[model samples]
Target: MFAPQGPTLRELAVQALSSVERGYDLLAPKFDRTPFRTPDAVLAPVSRALRELGPFDSGLDLCCGTGAGMGVLRQVCRERVTGVDISAGMLAAGRARAGVTATAPRVEWVRADARALPFGPVFDLAVSFGAFGHFLPRERPELFAQVHSVLRPGGRFVFPIAAPARPGSLGYWTLLAFDAAMRVRNALWHPSFVMYYRTFRLADVRAELTRTGFDVELQSLPELGRRPDGSPRCRLVVATRAR
Candidate 1:
């Protein structure tokens, strides 16, 4: 659901029909007002976890739309901080944020694809938030490799994952319908908008990370609390490249 200040139905419709880049460009101005922006509730817990594991130097926010994870990086990383994404409009939106502009460490915004990052092994930490749906399962290996390439030997790439929705729950049906609609939309549309909520599974992701040279670990984030099954509702994935 969108706020009153968010894009209207017609505006959202036009965006959904456009290429991913163009759609985001059209939506970027009001993106923070939409449900798509990473919420503070999620960001706060992940930030606390990163702080405990870090005191890291040069940091990177991969697929950093509107720089939510960059804020998390600023809390843990003492040196250079950078946010990279493919959409110029999204980067501009991030640049205009008061928090980003006043960050203590130097901040850089790069417009680049995550599948083919244009940086060397320079970062000590890399974090992403609420952007994985944009990447298909087939693209994930290369994307992981690209993140691997940018970090120093012992650097980390981290992100949070919520437990799968219960089979008969409202959340599960909602995501199921959303993914089905997206599949239909992609089948009929050109320059398809590639976002599907149900595609990124924990088991598959952990396997791929292990295959991509990361020493993978998962830590429960108690700050977010647990599910009815007594499992953590959310867990942080810490995948560190070997030194």
Candidate 2:
């Protein structure tokens, strides 16, 4: 769902047809008004979890389109917060709307691909929100490695992951249909808009994070509620760089 000021159907269609970078550029100004933005409900609980795990110094928000996760980083990290993304438009939108108070840490924005992040191991905390679908499964190793490379020893790479929809459920079919449509679209389209809903499985991702040198743990976010099976609706993946 979108607000009245959000991108129109025609605009969304145009964005779907463009390359990922250009599409986000066209959509950036209206992004926070769309359902695509990470909601406060998710961010709040993740921030609480990070606060318990932290008292951290420098933080990084990887693939931080419009910097929703930067707010979370600002809460738990004391010194500085940096948001990095591949889209200049997204970074510009985030910068315009940052509204940082004087008490908060210094905030910086950089335009760079997540597969090859530009920072050294200077961060004590790193967070990403709702941006992984842009990466293919095969690209997970490189992506995880880049995050690992940017974090200091014992620093964390954190993000939330929802439980998969139950098989035969409406949510399950919806994600399946979306991924199938994306595969078909990429097959026919140029520049390959790479968003897909179903390819980032938890088990596979956990294995990749481990192979990339993170000590992985999962923390349940109770505020998001639980499924009928008593499983958490969402869990934070807390992957620490090896000390």
Candidate 3:
């Protein structure tokens, strides 16, 4: 669901037909107006979680579309904050919205692919918002490795993950349908825009993080409440690079 200021149906159609980077570039200006942006509610708890673990220095926001995660970094990291994304248009929008005026933690916007981050081990913490679905399951290891490579030892790669919906629930069918449609789109389209809701399983993700040399931990975000079976509805996955 989109707001009145969000992308129109025709605009969304044009984006859906383009490459992922191009599509996001087209959508950048109105992205925060759409449901696609990471909610502030989610951001708040993640910030709180990081605060308990931090007092960190330089931080990086991976796949930082419009810099939602950058806000979280600003609160935690004292030295500098960087937002890395592939889309120039998205980076432009992020710079505009994030108000990087050179007085603050020295926000830097780098146009780079997340799979091949250019920075060295310069960050004490790294955060990503709602960007993982753009990466396929097979790509998780490399993605995690890139984050690991950029983070100093004992640094963390943190993000939120909502619990998978129950089989018969509306949320389940919606994601299933969305992922199925994406599969069909990729099958017929060029330069496939890989966004799949069902493929990013927690078990698989934890395994990939482990393989990438992260000591992974999952902490429930109680603000999102719990499922009928009493399991947390949302969780923050904190993957720390070993010292």
lDDT of each: 0.91, 0.94, 0.91
Off by over 4 Å in 2: none
Q: After superposition, how far is residue 124 of candidate 2 from its true place, in Å?
A: 0.5
Per-residue lDDT over 1-243 for candidate 3, one digit per residue giving the tens place of the 0 to 100 score? 889989999999999999999999999999889998888999999999999999898999999999889889999888899999999999999889976366657789999999999999999999998889999888888899899999999999998988998998999999999999999999999878888888888999998899899999999999889999999999999999995
Model 2 whole-model lDDT (C-alpha atoms): 0.94
TM-score of each model, in listed order: 0.97, 0.98, 0.97
In model 1, what is the error at residue 215, expressed in angstroms? 0.5
**10 residues in a row with least lDDT, candidate 1:** 97-106
- Please give the RMSD of candidate 2 to the true structure: 0.9
Can you write out model 2's per-residue Cα lDDT over 106-207, one digit (the tens) per residue?
899999999998889999999999999999999999999999998999999999999999999999999999999989999999888999878888899999
Write down the lDDT that model 3 would get.
0.91
